[model samples]
Target: MRVMKLNEVINITGLSRSSIYAYMAKGVFPKPIQLGPRAVAWVEEEIQGWLQVRLDERS
Candidate 1:
C-alpha cells in the first residue's frame, strides 16, 4: 500500500519519465494518486503487479 514517487517508479520499472507518462496517457499504465497540487504518487502494488504481468508475458 506504499506510494512510489516518479524517480522510484523509473528506477523500479526501467522506464523513462516520458515513457511512463505516455503510457499513462494511452491508458496502458497505472495512474498515480494525486497527493497535492504539486505532487503525485503511484501505488507500489499496482506497479509491482504491472511488472509481474510483463514478466509473465516473457515466460
Candidate 2:
C-alpha cells in the first residue's frame, strides 16, 4: 500500500490542513500512520476508498 503525506492528502482531497484534522477528530477521515517521531502519513488505498464512499453517497 502506498503512503501519502499531508500535502498530497490536501491535493487529493481539496481540503485544508485544519479541515483534515477536524475530520479526523470527528472520526470521519482515516487515521494516519506514524512514520517517525515527527512524521505521519495516510494509506493511499484508504484515502481512495474514502473518496469512493463519498462518490457512492452521491448516487
Residues 1-59, candidate 1: write the lDDT tens digits.
79999999999999999999999999989999999999999999999999999999999
What are the lDDT scores of the predictions, listed in order? 0.98, 0.97
With candidate 1 superimposed using the best TM-score fit, by how many Å does residue 49's alpha carbon deviate from the native?
A: 0.4
For candidate 2, the per-residue lDDT at 31 reads: 95
- Write down the lDDT that model 1 would get: 0.98
* Per-residue error (Å), model 1, residue 8: 0.1
For candidate 1, give the lDDT of residue 52.
Answer: 97
Error of 1 at 5 (Å): 0.4
RMSD of each: 0.4, 0.4
TM-scores, all candidates, are 0.97, 0.97
Report the C-alpha displacement of residue 43, candidate 1, in angstroms.
0.2
User: For model 1, what is the error of residue 45's alpha carbon versus the real structure, in angstroms, after optimal superposition?
Assistant: 0.2
Compared with the true structure, what per-residue lDDT tens digits does model 2 show for residues 1-59? 89999999999999999999999999999999999999999999999999999999999
| Regions of candidate 2 where Cα sits further than 4 Å from its true position | none
